[model samples]
Target chain A: MTDSKDTGEAGEVKKDHGVLYIGMDFGTSRTSVSASNGVRETVYSTVGYPKDIVSMKLLKKDVLFGKDAIERRLSLKLYRPLEKGVIKMGDDADAESKANLKAARDLIGEAIRIAKPRADELVYCVIGAPAKASIHNREAIIEAAREHVDSVMLCSEPFAVAYGLDWLEDVLVVDIGAGTTDLCRMHGTMPEETDQLMFDTAGDAVDAELAKQIQDTCPGAQFTVQMIKDIKERYGFVGEAAERVVVDLPVDGKPTPFDLTDQLKTACTVLIEPILEGLRRLIATFDPEFQAKLKGRVLLAGGGSMVKGLDTAVEKAMNERLGGGKVIRIEEPVYGGSNGALKIAHDMPEDFWEQLK
Target chain B: MAGFKETLKDAVRQMSFRTSLDKLKKKGVQNVNVLGVDRIIALIEAAVHRSLKSRMVGIDRDAVAESTKAEFLRLLRSNEDLQREKSQIEQARERAEEEIDLMRRELGEKRSLLRVKLEQDAMELVTRYSGENQAIAMKVAEICRSFAESGDASVSSVEERLMELVMDVVSGEREEAEVARKALQDREVGNLQRRIKKLNDTLVTTEQRLQQASTMKQFDRGISSIYREVQGLDGSDSHAGKKRELMVDLFKANLKLQKRGKGA
Candidate 1:
């Protein structure tokens, strides 16, 4: 049997409509989504528009997404629309700004599309934005998502992570994304401005640092930023070395193997000091009684948290710096923010959703 | 439940395959041993009946055979119904796709027509204005030449007055023409734009419908969520009160943000 409803006069059958809730983490390097339909997916926060008619014909699409965009970048006017976990736009209108805005919109649309939403469904989305994103940036994100959803809302990224895990009180979240790292102190209520800290020393910064380190140490090493990113993702670690990270890189057009264990360790260690400083500030400024609880429940999340031994390293640094503390990394680092947003979407009242719509 | 012979006859008819003589020949078969499908069916039925008849004496063997035939026929009919349903779904999908294509083509044609009309209107305005300007310039030049040939002391003054008078009349005409042209162009372009927009909306709606149909035809029911409707905080949750309060806070924040966005 088919599910359909008939109109009174037109006698046309309409499909049944269901409510679908989606949670999205719109990050700088990657965008991840979790939907009510048991679908979870992620895409690089990159969008590309074909450069010319010939390329358009060849590509057979007006836009390319994620890895496809990166691989076919020569034929496309590529755009990484988000910088520092917010849509990169200037006050003055320019071609680059317009393109970035379009890309951000397209990227949001693409992220929603991968959720496999049914057309005959009411789609409500909650997006986890940067904790310190400006009002203009928040509006831009909301406007972009509005084009693809029935109703959408924005929440602070680190707050979402904590909410998803049901850690309401005295827990500190360190969400290290590609563009920005957010440290939010949850105190059983909404986090305020002073309760959160954001900085640009995140995954992208680490990549830049790693690339610089390689360039300075390894002579004639030919590697791009992407290559450096891949190396970091595969071999980035702090603390003691586990195995020698000997990687093949082109040198003067020839493949050459270089041991990058020390370089990677040094580069990844850049996250520790800044994170410690942020932790010290949040912990020190907190109520004296719950400061220890906040320090003990420091949660490491985001793509950068996937680095091997990061939790242990952070704990080690905390023990040395803040008397003694405990650190826990979320099991699903990539989906933490998205899952939290989904939970919020679920808990949100229907009237609220309708009003937003 | 029919007679055994009749059931056999039906089974034979259902099992028979029709083929052309050329097809058999193409398969390199010079001659084939022909056996009637009904004869084979009868033999199989007879063997089954004989085996059953010997295996049990008290049981109603004829009834058993009849029920078996009825079940087999029922299954065959159900299979036919399923096949028909599949074919109908395929047809529906095909029709939807065709409708989408038609809508797309119409939208494309309407857009191109709009573009051409705009271009034509622009070209007409440019050509008409250029001709009018050229004629006005020629008349002015003739007036100046006449003044020069007279060799009067006030020739330059007369030429200047004549030029001003000609230019004023030309300018007034040009202004009227420009206003009329703009009004006409705007009306035509507005109508075309409305039509194109309608066509585009129709195309998009149709494509969405087609996609929905295709998805339905391709996938089974998707994984359903645990909650059928909107759910708030569970009462059993340990921090139900806290989560509810947080929900309220989140809602307030979003409500504020959305209201601000709308105001902007």
Candidate 2:
């Protein structure tokens, strides 16, 4: 289907459009659909609804996408497709599952559409999926892209992060995402299925634990998964001793200060063992030639990498196990996945798709 | 105590009869109705006429009294019989009323259930039936648009043809939609097309890989194995059909009518 839709319009960007590399760090908790179009920013992967068909019709749109979707969630159905890092089929009932996939597709589609490429633009994308996204999930994403753009490739999120840093050596890339913390070992080549490891415990788990702790301490405090996440992002840290910590809690429908130092530390520490275990396994997998190098060069990526004292905790645990190693944390959470995707789009020749197994 | 009171009453009535008979003997009265206009006169007349006449003209006075008394006693003996007959009439009336009430209740209940069931079914059918209807409608619309753009026919004929198409689609759509809606409301088909789609898409690559592995062997089996493997590409194509069927079922189950009041 072709249409003689005019170009050179006000809404259209008058740019070269070539060398315009687009990378989509499509994640479960939050998705940052960025392009080398101009600037980089991460938007939460969420969609919201309107009060009813009338409200949507009045607004002249069926649904709100991204941050707008979240802001107006009180009126609309809130959908997050990449639950646990992949689309889950609504078991026995599929309306919900279909809706999720459709919502995600629309969100991604909107982002790409907004980038506004020229007619002759070569639109290449390296969309991120969960490291352990079942084959079906990846295909669903690919199929969704059929109408969106020209060339699209699905890559693992952790691999994307690893690719962003160009750490193609014996580096253990641990991506602590919203739904799960994926650990992948890079041996200077495209990591195979054996090299990747996925576990369903990450930022979401900490938030859940923190919410439970808050509920237990303060009886009537209003809290939800999102609220707890906001709190965790603000005050999440891991350490032993600190000054007297006091945070507001709803005491009989009012905010009152109750020390949450012990609980916060506890919640932050919950993810320590899994990270350590992941590192140990990755280090052990190294064929004697790269074992020593792999020990010291452990890269922690994703938004969860920003947690205070996490590096120290991981380093300490590794020290206890391997006796010595260097643990480095990537600073740029926003462009990690995008940068990796862009690199893949650039490095892999156009004809390389023919060589895929 | 109640029985004793009844027996005493009977004895008093018998004594009065005896007194009346004596008074009748003293008087010249023969019948009750022919007696003079006095309380004793009425009683004496009744005893002489009713008791003595029947005795002299017929058989023994005691026997006549006993036999007449026996017949009268026999008539009053069955209290339950009167009650039973009255009860039978009442019971018949009650049964007729109850049957009418039950029939009315059943008719209303059945209508209520049918309406709910049909409405639910209709909604389900509308989604699928109307979905197909909508699909066909869209196709017709597309054809109309193409024809309009092409200038194949005059303006009036185009409009007329389009209207006819719309009418035909609506009627046919309604019938199928109703059937589909009923199927859905009746929960005959489980709408699961979307779910199957998600499953198929997500696992497409994995399934392909599995098939690839199954085909390839360690020793490189002959051309037969390769041909068999190539032929048995049990992946997206097979799942696509299943998904469509599931979708059709789902649409039927959750379809609601877009146009109208009741049946429409």
Give candidate 2's total backbone clashes.
23
Which segments of model 2 are wrong by more than 4 Å? A1-19, A57-60, A90-93, A114-120, A240-245, A249-252, A353-357, B1-264
Report lDDT per candidate. 0.86, 0.65
True contacts kept of each: 0.38, 0.00
RMSD values, in order shown = 25.8, 40.7
Prediction 1: B-chain TM-score? 0.65
When summed lDDT is taken over every stretch of 10 residues in candidate 2 chain A, the lowest stretch is A1-10
lDDT of 1 by residue, B1-264 (tens): 245456556646655578888999999878988887667866887798999899969998986777566645544454455458668778878988898788788878878888898799789979988997887778777766877887763956886778686778778898987898778758778987888888788878877877887776774534444455777668898988888888888888888887798688
Question: Which residues of candidate 1, in runs, are more than 4 Å off?
Answer: A1-16, B1-226
lDDT of 1 by residue, A1-357 (tens): 132342111122222457788999999999999999899999989899999999999997999999999899999998999999989999997989988999999999999888877655668899999999998888899989987777899999999999999998999999999999999999998899999999999999999999999999999999988899999999999988999999999999999999999999999999999999999999999999989888889999999999899999999989998998999999999999999999999888889887786
Docking class of 1: incorrect
Report the C-alpha lDDT of model 2 over B1-264, residue by residue, as the tens digit. 334334334533433534475688679766666322244434643774586775587556765545444433433333334446556556555555555455555556555666676677568656766677667868787877888798888878778877877787789868866875675543322323343444455445445544544444222311111011111112354333432332233222212211111123
Query: What does the lDDT read for residue A192 in candidate 2?
Result: 74
